[model samples]
Target: MKGQSRRRVLQAGAFAAVSGAAAGMTGGRATAAASATRPTSIPSARKSGGALPFLEGAFTPATKELTAFDLDVTGKIPRDLDGRYLRTGPNALGLEDPRAHHWMLGDGMVHGVRLRAGRAEWYRNRWVRSSQVAEKLRETYPGSAPADDFACNTHIIGYKGRILALQEGGPLPYELDGNLSTLRPYDFRSTLKSSFTAHTKYDPAADELHAVTYYPTWDHVRHLVMDHTGRLARTHRIPVADAPMMHDFALTGKYVVIVDVPLTFDEQAAQAGALVPYEWNHHHPMRLGVMPRTGGTVRWFAIDPVYFSHTLNAYDDGNRIVVEYTSMPAPFYAAGLGSGGPTATGAPTLDRWTIDLTRSHVTATRLDDLPQEFPRINEHLTTRRHRYGYTASAAEMWRAYETVDGQIPDTKFTNCLVKHDMLRSTRQVRRFPAGAGASEPVFVPRRGARDEDDGYVLSYVNDPDRGATDLVILAAQDFTGHALARVHLPGRVPLGFHGSWVHDA
Candidate 1:
């Protein structure tokens, strides 16, 4: 089964199950009616006396979408660089319950900086107008209606001459122009019938985009492949016991790595009023599935229970598959996204999992002990052996804070960017100033680059002292050396998820 037929069957089954679950959870009342009275964010049970951590400081939501011209630059901007650094994140208009707000729930706002000929051309931000946001703005909804009215606020990428703001689970992607203006909800020309994933690995060999997508209402996940022409080429549904939250996946030359961790959607929690209703389940079996890219039954391997939100890269090495990611040893967001900090149990670390095909065994190893997240690598080496990997320091951003005198004083913390020399078993770190934080480091290969690290690492660093943000560029080969350039912006670009350097075509 493929295309619309397969989608209809899956949607029918999912709707039935969702209806039954909602009825059971809400005593047969209409789901919409039940949801009307409940909080729009998370439950109030975990509400604190002060503002939520995600809504304060650098994570604060931007009030209006603005465009600035001719950004200030501290150092020489690379002449070869000509593109836009675009990122999307949750920026709420207004919360129904501020104390119960989850960090992950909000309207999507995209921030972008355009670079051309050694000059910072412009910096602009625009909200991806969902139905709710459109109504609030008194404008008609753009494009098609999205699934469940959820905003695409996780990652933004340029695919086939189109800028797409993406998020996992259920919702379709919101297409945007180069200026970061929302065009419409894009569904690959109406071919993507189920859902779209935020993280899609581009297979340079096949000239395709590979993704593992899951919907909260479905009990299975789909491995989707889009051909070089940006049309759906293949779809394979893989079943699981519970509806797991498969945020990201790994891609190798031969296999698509499926991480079926214990984090699952909870209907009860959703009915009881949790905006982001996924919770970690200890009873759920933690396993990994290796499925052939060509299509076949998945080979499942049981593993220790651990959650990883992002994967650096994976490759087929002889008879084994090597995977590296930022691993969270304990369950996270059990209550809600903003209920607790990510470092409650411990800071996440860069870890590796080696799966042996012949022995049908898996081994886990810690590559670096330092806390890190949002691992990235050179796109040219994706799905192949790579010498260098980059990550942002995760030590300070999500640290827990205590309320004092009905206020949670902002805690000053510093972060850094790391470069790992995988083959040499060494690493280099570049620490930021106190009260400063950096987003994910995006590697952009230099024009006509030769070596693997012959490129630049770009990140949006927020400086609390200046109350502004800067697009910091560093020579990837230099590792910890001085920055190549710092494009200063007028305001803070909130800490966001994955982004990419969309080169001019």
Candidate 2:
């Protein structure tokens, strides 16, 4: 049955490849655009945050699901690579009215590509059967075994043996099978009772997952710890000044850092019928609370107002803690504000915050002026300082990929990947062609790797020119030159959030 499913996916791809009408049907351009002029400005939605243009263009959800087997390999796939690369993003199953949309409110879908023994095994995309997706499919919201608030659209990972599909402000996770099939809601076997993060840090040394979870509807942020066995080991409340939508948090050797930014759930925005109710509240105090891993008192330090979707890494520096992330100069927009534009300039600079434990203050520094986001690092050196960080190049650097309907796309997009060297303050980048867009670069340490960065960095690139996707592998030692391998997919995979490389062993 799995083989049949894979064959079906490949057949669909072959049809799309050979059919001349597929360009119009799938929104693939007959020829690459001569130029792309995506606007940088957005509007403020007074009411009914309608029709985020970002969602329509490059972010459009597919009309059908697919499963393709034995994808073609363009280069030699290292035999050492043995795993599934799974990425999650909003893939709307149905949007009755495009005007009533937020980029974050779309239905959830996951795309997976497996590789083993130097073979591009298979490719599959599955929509998480959330209430919204279930309704679109005319199916019930599955069994009532373990209820959850699961968008399941942001990130996916393998925890112990369970593949957890995650979202922010959602307490429970939906577990998926090795083939990207949804199982059911998993709340640590119903031991958890609070919202969790899409970004959970797994400590390589401790062999535990640590998360500073926050519920948008609640006031307190909680620190959660799960053992290597995938059991909920501990949970404690981390005091916070406000209940901001904590998309991602920071991890250090001894602490879990919680950021309280200006993006808050707005009652007025909700009453105004905005699909995404969070807004930038300039008056709200921007602070960082450092809580011990053992769950003690939280030390709060006020900092300049800022917003960021991801952090590269954090580490302890004597009495001071250095946290590195990508932050912009203004209050970042939560969603496209009714097409007028986002809340601030979307450009992101590599920002560093040094939190002084003894002085009770934070020294803010702008390490790099480049526009970058989705900063990632070698996960093995997550808590401790490593030399390199990786990020998706901001959309402004690339021509926007057209959507199926060719409607919208003037928002955040990625076309290149970057690697930052912390010690020398240097950066190396790999820029995809004009019509190619890249996702977040996830670093996987090579088997029996010795150095912190002795590994490979992997990501998916959607090349509009080819109307397909590629799983590109880059040698960590070489930074970014040419891809070590490019496993070509038969169909397009939309831009997505976080993903994980699940080892088969």
Tens digits of per-residue lDDT, candidate 1, 374-419, equal 8899988889999899988633354532232224334433378889
* Candidate 2 local distance difference test against the native: 0.67
Scored by TM-score, the top model is 1
Best model number under lDDT? 1
What's the lDDT for all of these models?
0.72, 0.67
lDDT of 1: 0.72
Steric overlap count per candidate: 0, 6
Mark the 10 consecutive residues where model 1 has the least summed lDDT. 16-25
